[model samples]
Target: MICESFPVGPFQCNCVILACEETRTAVVFDPGDEADEILGSLARHQLKAVFLFHTHAHLDHIGATDLVRTKTGAAAGLHEEDMPLCENLHIQASLFGLPTPPTPPIDRFLKHGDSFSFGKEKVEVIHTPGHTPGSVSFHVPAFGLLTGDTLFAGSVGRTDLWGGSHPTLINSIQKRLLSFPDETAVLPGHGPRTTIGRERRSNPFLV
Candidate 1:
């Protein structure tokens, strides 16, 4: 597995490029902004993107979905429950005084337990809402867990936005996320990465 994550857009959402080194096939997670940079990374890695997966529909996470999809011809996916937020990019942008980007169409609706394979690598989708009604986390058994905004290094995702629920978010983290191994790397949407054990024992919200 070849995994690389970088922050993009003003919000600095973490954009991840995960690929199977043997097959040179990739799946891009959250092409928030800077389409050029995302594309460049794919080219640099000599990989072909087959899918664009979004953890949720927040503007900062889906802003560049269309551009990347157009360039790579990759299928775009999001949880069906977040379609409303995905369709309301303009409203989300207004709240932050940012430019509204085009709403990208979802080629697939991801569900809990969904699995995708790019060559020998496989990614399992875990429906872990709370941050948004449809928020999800991607788990690669051999690598790490992509928690989106659900679980962070020392904290957790905010639940003040549309469809967000504090109880649900906490439950999701405790049940869905915490079940992973202690050493499982946690690749959050923003900030530095940490491991499941570190967060479980010390994350203020979890502990």
Candidate 2:
């Protein structure tokens, strides 16, 4: 198992590259704005990307989707529920004063409980909608968890953006995220990584 995470784009969205060292098969999670960085990382590690999995569809989270897929020939994937958010890239970019890059149609729709493979590891999609209508968390139990906007290091996802609902975020956290084992390593979409047990005991959101 191999993992690499770095911030990309103006918003600095955390882009993660998880790969199987033995098979050299990888998945680029949230490509964001820097396609070159993503591809460079892949080259440095000598891994072949098989899938592009996104935790959600905010413009900042998907700024470089097309560039990455075009270069790597990897399948771009996102939650079905976030298509509206993904499609509204022009509006989303306008909100942040950034030029919108045309996003191509998703190659695949990721859904709850759906599983995808990258070499020896299988990742399951967990529909943890709160930050957005289609927000999800990727669970690779074999290599810990890659939680996107759904969970953070200490604080939980903000429920003030489009399609965001406070109650919904809390419900998703309590019902879905906390259900994982206490020891499961949690790598959120932003900020430092944390653990389920740590977030449960120390996080104000859980209390």
Candidate 3:
């Protein structure tokens, strides 16, 4: 598997592109903004995007969802619990005084335990809510964990937004994320990468 992550948009949301070297099929996580950049990455990698997966429906994480989907013909997937927020993109943008972009229709409803493959690599969905009711983390056993706004380098996600819950976020981190192998790489949505053990031992919120 080939992985690339970069910050995009005004908020600097981390967008990730994962591709299978053998088949050149890719899965884009959080196009966020900068459709041209995202598309260019795909072209540079010589990979075809087959799926666009969102960790949640937050404005920063989904700003260019429709644009990317339209450009690559990739199917957009998101947890069913976040549908309401996904549908209210305009309101979400309004809250931040940003212009509203067209909301993309969900091509697939993601759920806990759901698994999908791109070439020889597989991605498993772990429904880790709290930052948002439908927040999720993608686990690629051989690669790493994509903890979108869930667990960061020395902190955890903020649960002050719509459908966020502090207790639930903590529970998800402890029960769902911490259970992974200590060496598992944690690729969060907004900051530097860290391992499960590193977070367990030093993350201010988890420790």
Candidate 4:
């Protein structure tokens, strides 16, 4: 497994690219913006993207979904609960005073325990809502966990946004995420990477 995560767009949301080294097949996650940069990275890596995935439908997380899918011809997937938010992307963007782009059609609605593979590598979709009604975390045991905005390095995602719930988010983190080995790296939608063990021991929101 090969993986890279970087920030994109004005909001600097974290975008990740993961591929199977042997097959060079990849998956793009949370392409918030800078489709060209993301595409460029794929080209430099010599990887073919087969899927685009979103953790939620927040404006900053799915802003470039349409463009990415167009450029890579990859099918997009999102949890069903976020469909309404995905459809209202324009409205959501407006709230942040940002311009909105058209959203791409979701090829699949991910559910808990759902799995997909590329080049023999598989990722499990863990439905861990709270940040949004449909928020999810992708766990690839060989690589690391792609945890959108749900859990950050020292903190956690805010529940003030649409469909967000504090208690629910905590519950999701405690049950769906912390169960992973403490050493499992946590790749979030923003900020630097941390590990489950670190967060479990000290994350202010969790501890």
Error of 2 at 191 (Å): 0.4
- Which residue pairs show collisions in model 4? none
Clashing pairs in 3: none
Error of 1 at 191 (Å): 0.4
User: Candidate 2 — which residues are off by over 4 angstroms?
Assistant: none
lDDT of 3 by residue, 1-207 (tens): 788899999989999999999999999998899999999999999999999999999989988999999999999999999999999999999988999989998999999999999999999999999999999999987789999998899998999888999999999999999999899999999989999999999988987
Q: Write the per-residue lDDT of candidate 4 for residues 1-207, one digit (tens) a residue.
A: 888788999889999999999999999999989989999999999999999999999888898989889988999999999999999988988888888889789999999999999898988999999999999999987888989999999999999988999999999999999999998999999999999999999998888
Q: What value of lDDT does candidate 3 attain over all alpha carbons?
A: 0.94
Q: Is candidate 1 or candidate 4 better by TM-score?
A: 1
Better of 2 and 4 by TM-score: 4
Query: Candidate 4, which segments miss by more than 4 Å at Cα?
Result: none
Q: Which ten residues in a row have the lowest lDDT in candidate 2?
A: 141-150
- The segments of candidate 3 whose C-alpha lies over 4 angstroms from its true place after superposition are none
- Alpha-carbon error at 73 in model 1, in Å? 0.3
Instruction: Please state the error at residue 90 of candidate 3 in Å.
Output: 0.8
Candidate 2 on 89-202: residue-level lDDT in tens? 999999989999877569999889999888888899988998998999999978778888888988988889989988999898899889999999998988888999999999
Quality of model 4 by C-alpha lDDT: 0.92
Candidate 3 TM-score, true structure as reference: 0.98
What TM-score do all the candidates reach, one by one? 0.99, 0.97, 0.98, 0.98
